[model samples]
Target: MAAKTDDSGPVLPPAIEYAWGLRDRPPKGPRPGMSVPAIVDAAVGVADADGLAAVSMSRVAKELGAATMALYRYVGSKDELLALMVDAGYGPSPGPPPPGTDWRAGLTRWAWAEHDVLRQRFWLLHVPITGPPITPQQLGWMEDGLRCLDGTALTEGEKMSTLLLLTGYVRNEATLASQIAEGSRATGAKPSEMMPAYGRLLAQLIDPARFPALQRVLAAGVLSQDDDPDDEFTFGLDRILDGVDALIGRRAAT
Candidate 1:
């Protein structure tokens, strides 16, 4: 048999090719001794322990016991490393919602799953969104969200808009929660203490005569920490879903 030969052209960027397992390997010699997985894991650890601000090439290199320059052979830059960390942290998507489940239930589960990821890796919220996500794991989450509305009587554009709305709501909620938690940590104040203090400050700042609705809300004790965070998330989600249901019903009636 003749020596085997394969001929295929390069198909992806060097970094992405390496990510997809298509990059060239060093000739049979001393191994490079570093792997992409190790680098990403170190970066994730840094972010988890000290927040995204602590993640840097030198820090990750130090974590891996490798020279800072050596990391560049595997990851092109800190941006590449951040991208890898994002994809690695995403891991895998949740299983599809039970068959025939209503869109609301399916979507609520989807949103909660996303919330769990954001909460666990709270640093991700600080990762400036460079652009629409292109990584496999991120796209998989998008697909999962779309799948939730698979049976709905919606056009493709409508499906996208609905998903975007839900995603925005979830992201905003998570961001707010993270801010509140950070504030609590910084000020050493419990939510119970903070809410009332904030309410008092607002009450002091706003004239009751000029803001009747705000005064009513303040008097109703809505600023108290009586409601669990889960209850608040469910309430907002239910209201959004109800609005969608009304729109769908009106469309069907027409």
Candidate 2:
């Protein structure tokens, strides 16, 4: 697709416009079936199978059985390709919560929907956030999340901020889980073995007198084994919603 030239409004990346259907495919060069979504899907396939490093103009072109230069006719550059890939990778929003669901439950469902996507497509987490949500699917997610707060007393800005906070927590939790799993694989240790080993190592390295709080934790065997993976994620999600609930309460009160 060629870049949109009618720049009367806010300037946006071509891929963003392409995803939104604001840009049209050039009349001639690209192969008959080749289009923006087609190209983005092929690129996502490459990333999913071989990891993000395996994705490049040449590689994606090879997958599509086309010349590398030909890809430029559709995607202007690799950065543009990556952005489109992320939008496609996210697939779609889970849609708004069912009617009558409270805001906290809606946001919880929203947060988990995002969490599930990142966990499955961990590569999406590695993609740098060039800016805020602009692509269609990304904005769909933002819209659904904002819809959760539609009847709330909080201001529009507060609703957006609350979603931001929730998304950040979900991403951080997923990243930490992925990293820990990777670390366990690299060392060939079972996930269940990791915390116990860590606890033992810490016990030998610290002095009870100097690290009394930690010593008590060690004595209590808090790190004897890994907790259910969901336990940590659920705990953090509830705490964040608790704070949001309190704020919503304040807004309703005054």
Candidate 3:
């Protein structure tokens, strides 16, 4: 894998550099027992049990029963560790879209699969986007997403941009879903219970005269209703796909 770089070229962060095969494993550091994978896995374990905030080097070392310096043998910093953990969480791509699928169909599957991974590992949603996909699994996912646009009239740049757009949509949707899930867990209240309370708050706060569009939304009862997250996701995905199809059509026409 190609390493991440910049013109000024600060020392490459060890964890991501290792994943990109640009840096050596363990880097001649002490504690041969400490491996990058082990450190990342331990960090992930810490994050999983306590959340990303708890996944510091000290905490991860505590979880691994090693001194904090031992982890320094593997990961360069907590940010790199987080990058490794997030990419590890992805594991790998789910393989290419089904055979004979059109670009729309293929990209649709690609988007949904990406969405499902984020949903399953909701922690991935919380991982701050610091850089492009450099780790193996994330690169594979990027390739797979680009493959969905194979043979399309869209240029390579357009395919990459389309991926950025779709990825943003998936991440935003996953963030909302993850927040709802966390809220449910924290309050011990299902979304079905919580949304009504939420709607009522809006109802009390917004007068029809002051917020007619929002008031209309309240009157329609969609807010109070038990909305399926998947339905909302599908609606958004379809709209995006429609826009992409229009672009494809126009490109083909030209």
Top candidate on lDDT is: 2
RMSD of 1: 6.1
Candidate 3 local lDDT, 1-254, one digit each (tens): 23456887645666666777887555555665668888888877777777777778899888778899878767767777787898888888977777898888888888888888888778877788876667788989999889999888998999899999999999999998889888899999987788788899999899799899999989999788777889999999999999999998898899
Select the stronger candidate by lDDT from 2 and 3: 2
Q: Estimate each model's TM-score.
A: 0.85, 0.92, 0.87
lDDT (0-100) at residue 193 of candidate 1? Answer: 80
**TM-score of predicted structure 3:** 0.87
Question: What's the lDDT for all of these models?
Answer: 0.78, 0.86, 0.83
Looking at model 1, report the run of 10 residues with the lowest lDDT sum.
Answer: 1-10
**What is the Å distance of residue 113 in model 3 from its true position?**
1.6
Question: How well does candidate 1 score on lDDT at residue 153?
Answer: 73
lDDT against true structure, model 2: 0.86
- Backbone clashes for every candidate come to 0, 0, 0
* Model 3 ranges off by over 4 Å: 1-17, 20-32, 202-206
Give lDDT for model 3: 0.83
User: Clashes in model 1: which pairs?
Assistant: none
Q: RMSD to native for every prediction?
A: 6.1, 2.5, 2.9
